[model samples]
Target: MATDPNGTTQSDDAIDPVEEENVSGRASFTASLLTQGRHRFYTLSMPSDVLANTCVVEPRNEDPEEGFQRALDEKRARDIANYIDAGMGTIPTSIVLSAQPAANLQYKRTNRTLSFELNQRAFLILDGQHRVFGFRLAKTSLRVPVVIYNGLNRMEEARLFMDINTKQRPVPNELILDIKRLADTESDAEALMRDVFDLFDKNADSPLLGLMSASERRKGRISRVTFNGAMKAISDSFSGASAEQIYDVLSAYLICCKSGLREYSMEDLIVNPTMFKALMLIFPTIAERVNDRHPSSFTVAHFDEIVSPMFQRSKRAELSNPGKSPSLLVDSFRKALRSGFTIGGGNAV
Candidate 1:
């Protein structure tokens, strides 16, 4: 026998048995009682098997009166299960659940033990359905921290569900990348790109000084994501080149564009991500010409001799519209470069 918060009493046999025999057993565990405002709940460590058997997930129902959870993402559950099986993963966060009045939940504060009947639908999972499903799939028994709220109606359950899902802010992608870089967990190419971006942003002599935004977007600055994306495109082209060597080449190239490309300002052409990516797209072709002329030199004087003709002869109308997207801008730049400087063995116009 147990008394609910509403002063209703029910015997053990009053609980309706679920159709499945494996999930029909009752659950008893030591838990700490906690209160917030007028609401009271219990916290305990429940075995993964017991949690899977006793709890139910009701997906969002067509009727506003029922179900509050989203449908199970089976792939996400499987991924979590794999991570658990790998034996290195942990889920420290507590799963939130609500017991209906019919569950006959009783808390004995003397022993700090909470007991409840495990009927067909004893508990409604407010959150962590995917994790519970993962626990079900895992072979190793894990004791998951759980918070159980007693006698919550469908409406109350739905409100709590929304509060948890909507109110919490997810971590930003830029912060994740920065954390990975600090932890030394990012890929080799990503590390290289970040290092180069830092050098460009901090180096006084670099053309891109004070022009990179590492996290938040700023007016008149290129974002770290855009810079990293552009660098990824050129990583293969500059495969064997050291970070310093790549920095020098980029520095020399930008200086030439700034000095010779009198048609457009550097702010529109170089500081803009789309135009910068387009410029990088044509870098290998220009570098090939520079290499052909001066095999041992990648200095500003050498890059200028090869690239200045293309910059001077390029039409303002062709290069002015950077909003046409990177691929379109690449085509426009390629056309301008070809018209200004002949390919293969031909001299610059």
Candidate 2:
């Protein structure tokens, strides 16, 4: 082994003949020096034929065939492959790799060829494994771009895998609210209420629990835009409140309201955007009433206490109520709020 001037020991394994470029009109790849993080690595461009024959996926276990990476989602892979075959979209994404030197690999910068034994265990795919596999299915001679990390252990490879998959994947529309909540790009009232929106969507005990859809498989009951608008109407209540405080107080009242209306389906009450908006119009008043009743020791129970009377009053506003027109719907919710808590209310339609 040879030590660099910086005390970093470079791999001094025997130079395999694979490091030599092919002059026999056969396929070959060359590497360029790339920045090193925990270990040295190189970037290269290889033909799809070479990638299919040489690249390997290091799986964590044998129970699920593709457990280490996402399950081989063949349908998705086939779709991408078909797209490639049709020459519709160019696959410009690079395949990220982590190779264990002990697993028969050598990074020879002097020769510019990344030498490795061709097998399924030679490397762990940190990213773009699906794309690589899809290219294999495409059976085309397209070039595959790659970034290979040398001598990465399993943990380091896993971390890189997670970072790439989570950060690089397109943000689902349902989850745009979450990313925006943490992002500093927009600090307006609507953006800030996304913090509360996340709570209602994710928290288990929330009335809005499991109500927001974040994936193609399941659709959320209410639209995010409508929900954000409702929250914005009551944004002043959240002015000095932390995410936890906003979640706790709102969750308490909403959960109680959900439970109180046992006769009506929770679905019926929550699926309607207008009803949700009307309640938001009245939420500030509910909070004030509870705070006034228990000035120092305000608790979830107090919020629940205030929401109890509104339950019976709001029943007429249910989507199932035949005689309930849109105007009457808003009026019923206002009456419901006034029955239990004193609120300066107005039309929410």
Candidate 3:
């Protein structure tokens, strides 16, 4: 430790850069000059142990709840330390630092030595707090990279941090595309459709459970993409209904349809996307007529009544032919529903 004229002790190993470009007369640190976008800053490579001793993290932001930098996460730090110990090549990105003008730090260009009269707390970490914490946890003497912005006020430091995070580090294109397919937030209808698809995937009572493409393919015959498309194709059919309500109605209908069959596999119906799409197109009309008589009392019998005539007219035996298009079954079912089916008591018309 070296004592300055003001009686403040500083690190004896404090370094000064061999080259520095003066900027606005506040560049008092010797460092290699680097430019990013329009901002020029100083870069330094220092030992991890030295940085642990010389720097301190000061958490600052306009909104504490939604701040850019957070408190040192010890769990994350320990994980990083363990990662380093495993001999896995972990690249240490640049840590950002800032110092206020009140610190009275000076750099002598000739000898390339920094003369400072302040303690470690005089410095602020604008970014990479977790990395420094990790180094402390590791207790390793590894070299770390850092970027310094001298004589910056709190506002300037925060702005620079925001710029470095939001403006420079863009999200990868592949990630955006993946997110688009997974959780598309284009419209309310798309969001609701995803929720309904998830309902089919997760609900144990659902006939389509474990058969939708969202679940593991052990018995899941439907592809997630195809199921989502089917749901979107008929999204407007369930206007004003909540996601759970839509799921319940669909689940009830499928259960009824399956119960009426003497012997049929849910997997068989799910495997064909065309069959699912045809169901989507036909469900709305059937649901309206059944709900009128049953009035929220949906049952397997009601499903039988609605589906029996349609099945009989469609000559579903023809469905076994691989050469037949699904539209044939769809058209026949639509015609049967229009011609009206008997509900055991009388004609549904």
Candidate 4:
């Protein structure tokens, strides 16, 4: 017999069928036995409440090889907990764990049932500690998929933990954004920005046609990651506007920029990620100026009439200063635009 954390005792030789409650008062459920090479494991669904109470994480001490897991990130756990409590989150991946010999876990192959005593520190969390902690914090209980490896020693557990954490490459943000766009799973703001990117890449009249690189960086092309980042700085400016409408205003602005700043190469000033973002940051003021003068007209010609003189007066060396930071460059451009313009015998630049 083995004693659990709560002083409950259970026979070590006991094995129960599916859906039966064992002597320790914990319910035993059906599980699938799986093997990879010589190693065997069991996959089962455990309720969040039970899982949270049963599993423990042993973070490494001052000794380098003492433990396998890292310290729990409290903020991440809180965020995940909040997401789960809001009824909008789902954890589809299995929480991987190892049952040490002390756990006394029993699996009945005839009925495909697995049961274990709730002994203190019975299971070691190999992965998904943050998620498990989130489950512990959430008010609602969830049926979580769990993979349990039985009778693994400390060294074996450590090796498995290292392999999982180090060998797997995380998905890139660019690919995630692209997937969200294609699957229509993104938020409204994200969807709108993605559509704007599509127009800039494919539209015939766009000044930036064939200049948006979706995956990786390319010569003379702006990456999707950079483009999305720049758009975020001005996304609020297009409130209540459709993707096409937003594209129209921006495309017109860029056309004017391309024409007015013809002295500099496209990659050097206009389409450079830093310069492009700086340009986007100042667009709201320019749009307001256009709206004030033309009253709802935002054409390329109208923008040119306003910005052409500013570009003419500005020095390329100063505008493309490599020493200045991106924010400083934006401020310099704003100052230049203000200093260059004079409306009705007063300083409007």
Can you give the TM-score per candidate against the true fold? 0.72, 0.44, 0.43, 0.74
lDDT of 4 at 14: 29
lDDT tens per residue, model 3, 106-139: 6554554443333455457777777777777784
Off by over 4 Å in 2: 1-28, 58-67, 101-103, 172-349
Best by lDDT: 4
Tens-place lDDT per residue, model 1, 1-349, is: 7776788885432332221223345567767889998888988777788788778888875344576688889999889889888998889999999997656888776667677787657788998999999988888777788999987777788888998899998876666666787776899888888778888888999887878777756667877777888888877778887788889888898877767555466444677777778878878878888888889588899888766777666667656767848888777667766775456766653
Error of 3 at 27 (Å): 35
Ranking by TM-score: 4, 1, 2, 3
Q: Name the regions of candidate 4 deviating beyond 4 angstroms.
A: 1-22, 25-29, 37-40, 59-90, 107-113, 151-158, 179-186, 213-225, 259-262, 266-271, 289-295, 305-325, 338-349
**Candidate number with the higher TM-score (1 or 4):** 4
RMSD of each: 8.4, 14.4, 15.9, 7.5
Q: For residues 44-152, could you state the per-residue lDDT of candidate 4 as single tens digits?
A: 8878777887888888853466776788899998898898899978888999999866567888778787888766566889999999998888898877889999988
**Lowest-scoring 10 consecutive residues by lDDT in candidate 1?**
12-21
Top TM-score: which candidate number? Answer: 4
- Tell me how candidate 2 scores on lDDT: 0.65
Clashing pairs in 2: 213-220
Q: What TM-score does candidate 2 get on C-alpha atoms?
A: 0.44
Residue 334, candidate 4: Cα error in Å is 2.4
